[model samples]
Target: MAELRRENQKTTSELKETQKRLRQLTQTIRELEEENSILRAQALKLKEDTANRDLSFSRELQQMKEQLQEKSCHVSLSSYTHATVPTPTLSPAAKPPTPPDPGNSPIPQPSPTSPTLTPRDSPSDTHSLPAAQPLNTEPNPDRPAKPEAQVVLLMDSNGKYLDTKRLFPGLITRAKRCQNRGQAMELLRQDTLGNPQHIVVHTGTNDLHTLHRETAEAMTKMAKRASREFPDSRVVISTLLPRTDTPPHVIHEINMEISRSCAALPNIHLAHHTNIGTWDLHDGLHLNKVGVRAFAKTLKDVTLDRNPNSLAHTAAPPRNYRPPRYQQERQSNTASHLPAAPRPPAACYTLPSCPTQPQKTPPPSPMDDLRLCDEQSHPSPTH
Candidate 1:
């Protein structure tokens, strides 16, 4: 009986120990389940935050694209005007009167009856027109005409003042606010009219703030189009300026996209920063004074170095051209020697000398009369 009781006690102790172990395991499993739930909640929150960030970035990019487009349009228009406008040459002896700076006040228009003067006889002129005489007229036979160059600025409203102050200290910059795509288009149009040879584009900050994709697309398109439109002109597309306060991942993604876009464009050049890692920001968008100066100097050097041949091309007149002075003098001498040109005779009633047959007028052909009537008349087939 004693042996049987001892064996029973041993079995009881083993059973109690096993039960305790099982209970501990159950508690451990419950704690694991709670941890998994917390982790899942955190994952969901992260996903939602990422989604919100993406949406915000998209909106900002769209707004920026719109602004860039507007600015581009304006620039195009300005460039076109510059190309078409006739540039007048000034003579040494007949210098044009120093017109008052138009910046201080409105320019006055000359009256139609204002004293008319020829190019040679004007009192204000200090330079004389080149003579049509032989090339031997040069005082220094070995010297060639020195080439002249001018610098012009191209920018939208946000950072244009920096360009004006740094690059073109003598001249005033006409700033066009790039509020949307329409405005950017207008700016481009103006720039085209103006024919700026070197363009520095500083944009994309507002787009980041707005998270607009269209802004990037528009900017890329503009850079591409500018390459075609202004083949002679160089287009410098700046990298998206840094925003340090934003999340590291977001900033990295935005900059990566910008760099990618710039790389895709064949004609667009990326501006180099001294410190690539340093985030330079003005209100999280524009560059500060030091940044602007660095950018301007880089641009200036690039522009000056790129076009060495242009200097010689712009300096010399065409081989076939004759000087205005010779033409003028020849005309004056002819006038002095010859009788005044005869005036047209007044209408008088006179009989026809001989009867002439009326010639048959040719009828207009179908090809000659073909004209564009309406948009619908020439509808393009859908692809």
Candidate 2:
């Protein structure tokens, strides 16, 4: 009974020890959760601070950029002002004029901010400044520019030259008043014709009234000569604008000749007469503003296209329109290039005009006729 009582007391003490250990473990878990919550709060606060710092830094950078732009603008304005100020071109004998008294003069005394330009400067020098440009001197970064096309245009008075501006940019005009295909042909014979990328021959309308076919042939010849003169330049021939003097059939025939002649020429382009519509006319030949517009539009289409290899040139037809002198010279040149042929012997020819001189033929006269009659009357005495 004594041993059983001791065993019960030992079991009671062991249960009390286990209960104390369980309470201590619960208190340690509660402390760990409080520490975890505090760490999470600190991490969120750090992220917010980083975001705020980035925003403030970005604002400061933008402000700095604005300030730099303002400074650059001011510098450019000052430089432009200095460049435009007239530099006095004074002669050795010229003296500076005396300044007026500030108190006596009605005009206010000049401020000392900037030096005044002198009146002694010549008008030419003042007008022709070194670098006079607008105040905003900085070139635009976004502007994509191209060099202007430099072209020389030769046209007759009937040509509406202003209409060409719509298509031909940077055009230099050489318009002749009261000119025909013949006159335009004469201009091509000049020795020094400048080399241009585009050479426009807008003529033949004046001569199309009576010489429509001939004028068309002459125009083709003109295109050939222009090509020869400016070997590097492409000759663009604009067709005769709408005119009442020539029938549509004549116009069609002329256009056909132009196409045929210009086909072989690699540089020649024919601007066909298109129905860009018609304009009113008094003499049935002169092209008014509307007719000119139509012609210019046709020209625009021709120039935009670079290929002109389809047009074939007729060797014999184009030659007909060439000047007589040119034809003779060409013949001589061709003959010179040929193989030398044997000449006829001097002894073989008997005529006076031959290589060997001979007797001259007598001239017939009325005196010879009277002598013949006398001989007949005296024939009986002689017998």
Candidate 3:
């Protein structure tokens, strides 16, 4: 009985100890949870603070930017206001008297004592005033003539494709657009503006598909008429540019016809754009930026009459002639060990009136094997 009592007492003590530990653990858990809640609130507040700081900073930056822009605008406005002051106009009475011409004979001087007459003196004094000479309407031959303007005639674009004026500042560019050669001729006829130093006609690209031979004839006639109309100025007939839609041979034929016809006229010169290729054009018809730049340069050259020897008259090879890449390939394929064939001498196209002297051909090298292939491909023209 005694042992059983002791055991029961020990069991009760262990249960008490376990209960005390459980209560302590509960308190610790509650404290941890409170601390966690506080930490969460603090984190949330910190995030909000960060967000507000960023937003405020952005707003401040935006305000600064706006202020800077306003300052710049104000500065520009002030500068413009200060720079463009209106010039005061002088009335006729305020204008200084014209200096007497030395060429005219001097009037006899009145006696110094002769009543020092004022304009308010009398109508009789007005008679002593020299009679006003009638204004001369005729142009003075002695005066230096004003610089002549240059005119460029386009088909559809109104010469917007190329700005010749921007390229050549000295030149006064007058741009006019026409539909075709006929319309161009009519427009030229209607233009009452006095003769320009240079008249560059860049039309007929629009007419290639519609009219073949007639386009050439019309362009030739237009050139003739322009020459007649602008006898003092040089009439530059720009050959038809190559287009993707039209066969090159057709364009070549028309250009050849124009060349033959215009060759007789001394004042007429052809601006050959033979170097232009399909790569230069955009949309297969119109010139892109690159082409426009080149076209503008060519116009300037022709207008200034520079590079007279560079004018290309022939449609075929010789002027600006470059050997085909196939020739090099053929040479490589046929004889790898042998030296490449000597290239033909380069030549510039000249007018028939001033033909370029023939250049002697270099001796054939082992690469001449490609010449056989070339001859088969491009036979020499018969005279």
For each candidate in turn, the TM-score is: 0.34, 0.40, 0.42
Best by lDDT: 3
Question: What tens-digit string does per-residue lDDT give for candidate 2 at 299-381?
Answer: 66686675434234211222223333434576799899997788889878866664767879898689999998988888755
- Looking at candidate 3, the ten consecutive residues that score lowest on lDDT are 314-323
Ranking by TM-score: 3, 2, 1
Model 1 off-target regions past 4 Å? 1-152, 156-158, 161-182, 190-192, 213-215, 248-252, 262-266, 272-282, 301-383
lDDT of 1 by residue, 7-106 (tens): 9999999999999999999999999999999999999999999999999999999999999999999877655544332245556676645768756757
lDDT tens digits, residue span 1-383, model 3: 99999999999999999999999999999999999999999999999999999999999999999999999998777555444333444556655556576568497556777776676975764554445555444445565665546664444552576665586686676777776776777766525546777777778888776776688888888889888887888778888887766766788899999999999886888887876665666676777786787677677788787874546543343354443444446667889778878776555444357767999998888678798888989999999
Measured with C-alpha atoms, the lDDT of residue 19 in candidate 1 is: 99
Q: Which candidate do you rate higher for lDDT, 2 or 3?
A: 3
| CA lDDT of each prediction against the hidden true structure | 0.58, 0.66, 0.73
As for candidate 3, its clashing pairs are: none
What is every candidate's alpha-carbon RMSD to the true fold?
Answer: 36.2, 21.8, 25.1
Candidate closer to the true structure by lDDT (higher is better), 1 or 2: 2
Pairs that clash in candidate 2: 262-311, 263-311, 263-312, 264-311, 264-312, 264-313
Q: What TM-score quantifies how close candidate 3 is to the native fold?
A: 0.42
Stretches off by above 4 angstroms in model 2 are 1-88, 91-149, 163-166, 170-178, 209-212, 276-283, 306-383
